[model samples]
Target: MSAQRPKILIIGGGFGGLFCARRLAKADVDVTLLDRSAGHLFQPLLYQCATGKLAIGQISRPLREEFAPYPNVKTLLGEAIVLDPDAHTVTVRRPDETEFVIDYDVLVLAAGMRQSYLGHEAFARWAPGMKTLDDALEIRQRIFTAFEIAETLPPGPERASWLTLAVAGGGPTGVELAGQIREVATKTLANEFHSIQPEEARVLLFDGGDRVLKSFAPDLTSRATQALTELGVEMHLGVHVTDVRRDGITVTPKQGGPDQQFAARTVLWTAGVEAVPFARHVAEVLGAPTDRSGRIQVEPDLTVAGHPEIFVIGDLAGREGLPGVAENAMQGGLHAATCIRRDLEGRPRRPYRYRDLGSAAYISHGHALLQLGRVRVSGYLGWLAWGLIHIAFLTGVSNRVSTVATWLASIARPGRFHRAFMLGAADRPEQRYTYSTSDLPAEGHAPGS
Candidate 1:
């Protein structure tokens, strides 16, 4: 062999890892991109999928397909379970539990974060977080099924409980969820329901902060509050969700007041996030420091101290003034790729500098918020801008096309197209259908027949 190319191994297929790999596609180094899941998910649109506004396919694309054009990049499906810094190898566990080792000359950790239950893991069973596709599907099931269950029950507190939905968090995700739930009730299922009026559904939003969308400007938050209020989302601020149960949640006032309870059948969580477990493991193995949220602290060049070969980026990266957003991850990925290319070219690496590209949040139909430096836009104008921004950043062209088409269709129609959900084994046993065999058409007398 004339020469050996540098082997670059990247963990996670989120925005950071994927963008980094793409940036290094034409480089001489061989790259291995690995992730636990097979698809690259557009996480910002996950709430839309959960609310039946978009399909799973519209928000995610297969990673292998995404990287097929780059012959130098190889994709693998596995979870990084163990890290050995001395050996420069990472141990990964396959879906079948088989263990394998990947050795690399350069390593990039961008595994991202997961929803935090605030040290209450048990709450996950009752309140599904909007972090993954599975979580979105689970929330979809609970949301649509709750309405179906309510349609069968007589008008009473039980029906009201089934129609009541609770959302924990005042951030972008929580705001989007609360707004979508109300829209789904008032517009989508208004004419579909028979017994209980879907418009009467209750959407309760609880957050410990004094106001919603704390990350945005105060004026933008006020606009968002007005939109949500008009849409009928009950805002319960200055309260912490102390307990989450199967049928309801208990909230305690942050300023020291008596705890209160709200009965709800559907609970969605988007309060906080912590670095994924593998990121924590990598921090320990590499002797790197991490924050309380388990984000690995990186040097100015986005590399671990004393370990130039190792780079940490994205939400798992802990840096002052670096917001845990997609734009940061994308920029960090490009910077890391540039550093690698510079090393190959015998040039000195430069520090990573982040550019503030602003942030956006959707409130309801024809309402959104967009904030740039000293510039804020809300209402219909912000809504249009929000659509354009999301479409521009969405992963694939096909996904963008489909998502836009779906959105247009949703605007013209009164019902959600992707509302189907499957019942799990546990739920199947407890389900009681309202209709029987008599409700179906006779064997040879189908509607078409």
Candidate 2:
């Protein structure tokens, strides 16, 4: 609506938002990119950072630095709290909770999803999900600190509890986290400590599905299972994590059976994800239909019904056959950009057609799985392809180079140079949980039968 160049407002700096902005970098438009976080996280490799295989800097790039070359793109740090589609304005809350307004002619909602606790939000204190930089750091701290705590305790149940790690999810994130933890225990910290054998640590992976990596073919899943088993990861499939506490988790069979309790000090959650809070608010204001997970249903052109100026993409877009993956998000972003360009030129906009680029998952050291159409590759060959695909998709040349260097060094030796983690309020026991001591399970025994 501006007499000047059209004002384009993009909410989020993830794959979708970033790609859209980059495509419009030289366009005759003023772009405002807003995100709650300063850096654009490379989420696929978040587990690597959590397990110390890569540094946070290697997996994330600051938005300011990323957009320094794009004169038309102005990046701001804020969380979009309210949407006024009718007025073409959005209210954003700053880091200090102060509110401001942003006006736009065209809006792009690429704000991605957040870790979902399903229905139990209280489980968050005990189980940290793999979604953000803070989550990665928190998991890293828990992992390394658990090892250190185990070293101090003599051979006993408490030490074993500290050495036990649990991951709740069979998806790519869960599988990657489980495998990386085992690899870290058996390889990186195997001989680093004299008090206890780090290789003896137990990593339990739990999922309600019958097998891990259910997105892949049965053979690929079988190969992943074998690789995980060989890496010393105990797979507990066909079970649901019913309850989580400060000390352990209770798993009940999905087919209805007695519950089994596992004492684990560190639990990483990658079970599910839902739209971020802002995305939900946007959906409400726009009267858009969303799937169960809060993904807004969009027209074929990635626009809301009766609101073609507003585009929704990435994990937040609910469309048939549109997988919530980085490749899909990137392509969606470009499509949205192309639509906007076409609109400016008075040309008819085309519907978005998502191209499936397949999927890849890293299992362990020198092992991975890659599937594209009928082409299924596993083991060393698959690992190489997986690495190439990731490296090519990673943003920025510096990040790609550093990540490759780090990977090569890690492969050549057992040393993990980025193992350092911080301990702040996490060091305090009283600040951990709101529940009283009476809420804990009986000593030496779990609560459920």
**Per-prediction TM-score to the true structure, in the order listed:** 0.93, 0.95
lDDT for each residue of candidate 2 in 31-66, tens digit (9 for 90 to 100): 999999967999999998898888999989999998
Best by TM-score: 2
Clashes of each: 0, 0
lDDT of each: 0.89, 0.90
Clashing pairs in 1: none
RMSD of 1: 7.5
Q: Write the per-residue lDDT of candidate 1 for residues 176-269, one digit (tens) a residue.
A: 9999999999988989877989999999999999999999999899989999999999999999998886668899998998999898978889
| Model 1 poorest ten-residue lDDT run | 432-441
Q: Model 2, which residues run further than 4 Å from truth?
A: 1-3, 425-449
